[model samples]
Target: MWHSLVRADNLFGPRHALTAVHQQLDVLQGLLEDSRGEYRHEVLRLSAQYAESAAWLHEDSMDMASAETWTSRAMEWAMEAGDEAMLPWTLFRRSQLAAGKRNAGQTIGLAQAVQRHERALTRPMKAAAIQQEAQGLVLDGDESACHRKMDEVHEYAASVDSSGDARSGHGDFCTPSYIEIQRANCWLNLDRPDRAVDTFQTALAELPDVYQRDRGFAQARLAIAYVGIREYEQAAAEAAAVLDMARGSGSGRTLQEAVTAGNALAAESNVPAVRDLLDAVKESAGF
Candidate 1:
């Protein structure tokens, strides 16, 4: 049931994921009120899972206040459940929020905390955390540090590939392709959209079918990269595709990115494709 919810989140993005979390919280509260001993540990562990999922959903929606609340709740439940696996993951989640806000100090600090427990983490989790440090470095304007960390990330990615085991059901998004996606994001942050475009396209080629939301993110960023390079037609096409995916999945983040890209394209080009894309964006974004 939990894995299915995670699949739904990966496919549909935050709004649906938030819905799933609410349902779990409701179930947890009912179980608590009933005081069922047989399910005691299960409830606590599930609480941590739902709370962490909620934190990520809120963070993706840019609701930092709610994100922080859920992140704290997640940690509390993790401790109560004796779930040490969740420790670094929750910190990783917090780092994501900090990254979104461009708070490089907080992002790097949280990722280092994850590394402190390096032995406990699965390779995929470790790779994801290290890549996040690279993300923070990009935001911190530390190109040298970012490049060094990315090298470490590739080594971790190789380990992930060599291991035949499935990604930890801990739900860390750390596939080898996901690493390249993060690299693309770093390039984007560095104002080198040409490099971002190359990396983003590579990541898109191999991203798992289940990661529909992740694919949308890459596509949206690719659109932004096209605009950065003054390829207005390509940008419009990519943005239009993003809007279609956004509409299908009810993904607010996707809609916003598409709209932002569409607006930029509209400003630069008066072509029919650009105009149509802008109209779609405005309708989707209610702008």
Candidate 2:
């Protein structure tokens, strides 16, 4: 059911997907409560994965309370499973959510917690921590600290070869391409549009074809970068691509980012592309 919902090429599909995932998780919670014998390790693992999924879905929906609840559950299940990889990765998701909320203090605290628990973390986990720290620093307007964290990310990435354990974390957490995308976003948030554009292009070069949502997000950030640089034409092109990708994705986070970018462009009345994007946004509701 999860596969079918995720594979469906429409907005309703993703909406249904979220609902199905949540329902499945409820069933799993019931089973966990009713279990009589020794707890199954696989069940614990599934619980962790489901919790992580719920947290992600909640974050996408901008439901911070739900997101935090699921993240806490995910961490609990991961610890129960003795799944070190899951712990840091889940924390990383929380940090990202905190960053989205512009809670730089919370973001940095989460990232620091992950780093303090680094003995259990894999190289990719370390990279994620560094990326989150960088983002927090960016939000706090600590340019030097952000750059320092970015450097740490590069150092961590350089230390690991491509032949390490493939399953470092749950889901797509272990992918280098994912790390690159996060790094690109950090650059964007730091107001380094040129660097953001370059990093995003690098991410696209190595990124797989499966994660359309991630790709769409990168495109949206790219649009913002273009806007930052006064490249209205390129920004418009990227925004159009983002709109096309978001048409049926059911990703509230992406839609929100697009709306924010569009609203920012509203100040530039002389730019036709900006006016057009703003008009498009005004015409659309429920984003």
Candidate 3:
């Protein structure tokens, strides 16, 4: 069931994946209530996993309130189970949600909290938390500090044993390609869209096929990068691709980025491609 939920998120995107997540959460809750001893601990861990999944789905679907609720629940279950790994993971997840809110202080604080659990974190987990903290630093306008932390992120990520403990289901996406993609986003935020365009193109080329939704979001970001450079034709093309993915997958994250791309192209409204893309984005926004 958990594997199915993961596949659903990858293939069908968040809105569709959320239904399965909620169903699994219901089952986990029932099992957790009646569990005892070691079995109870296992159930609590499972509960935390499902709750985290729910939180992620909600976040992807642009429902921040529900995302926050489920993240807190996941944290509660992780702590109750004394799950060393998941406890820090939940804090990292909270940091991600904080990033979505543009709360740099909260994002940095929560990511630091994750790193504080040094003994509990896997290498990938450590890299992820540190990368997240670096992103928060970017938000706080600390460019040099962010780059230094990003260097550390790469160092930790390089040491990850792909075939060993690093392959553990959680935080497995912290690969070199993923790290590069994140760096591209940080570049975009730092107002270096030229570098972002170059980096995003390279990272996207290496991204795994299983991460379809992530690809969609990345492409959407690329569209925004094109807009930043006044490349209206390229932006329109990329936005059009993102709109198709958003329609098929019901991805609010991708759709929202498409909207952002369209808004950024307002000055190029006279261009035929930009006009068409804007129309599609406006129509999609209604849904």
lDDT of each: 0.80, 0.71, 0.86
**Model 3, global lDDT:** 0.86
lDDT of 1 at 6: 74
Instruction: For residues 69-124, write the lDDT of model 2, one tens digit per residue.
Output: 99999989888877777787788888888888899999999988888876777666
Estimate, for each residue in 1-287, the C-alpha lDDT of model 3 and write its tens digit: 77667777877788777887788888889888789999999999989988998888888888889989999999999999999999999999999988988899999999999999999887878889999999999999898888888888876673323432223667767777778888899999999999999999999998777678888999999999999898999999998987978877778888899889999998898999999998898788676
**Which pairs of residues clash in candidate 2, taking residues 3 or more apart in a chain or in different chains?**
none
Q: Indicate which candidate wins on TM-score.
A: 3
The TM-score, computed over Cα atoms with residue i paired to residue i, of candidate 1 is 0.90
Which portions of model 1 show Cα errors greater than 4 Å?
33-39, 158-167
Clashes of each: 0, 0, 0
Error of 1 at 74 (Å): 0.4
Q: What TM-score does structure 3 among the candidates reach?
A: 0.94
TM-score of each: 0.90, 0.81, 0.94
Cα lDDT tens digits, model 1, 1-287, are 66667777787777676787788888886786766654776788788888887887776675779889999988887877778788788998889888888899999999989988867787777887899899998999998899899878766663333222233545356777888888888888899999999999988998877778888978998899989998888888898987877776666667777777887786765788888887787677552
TM-score of 2: 0.81
RMSD (Cα, Å) for all candidates, in order, is 2.8, 4.1, 2.3
Q: Is 1 or 2 the stronger prediction by TM-score? A: 1
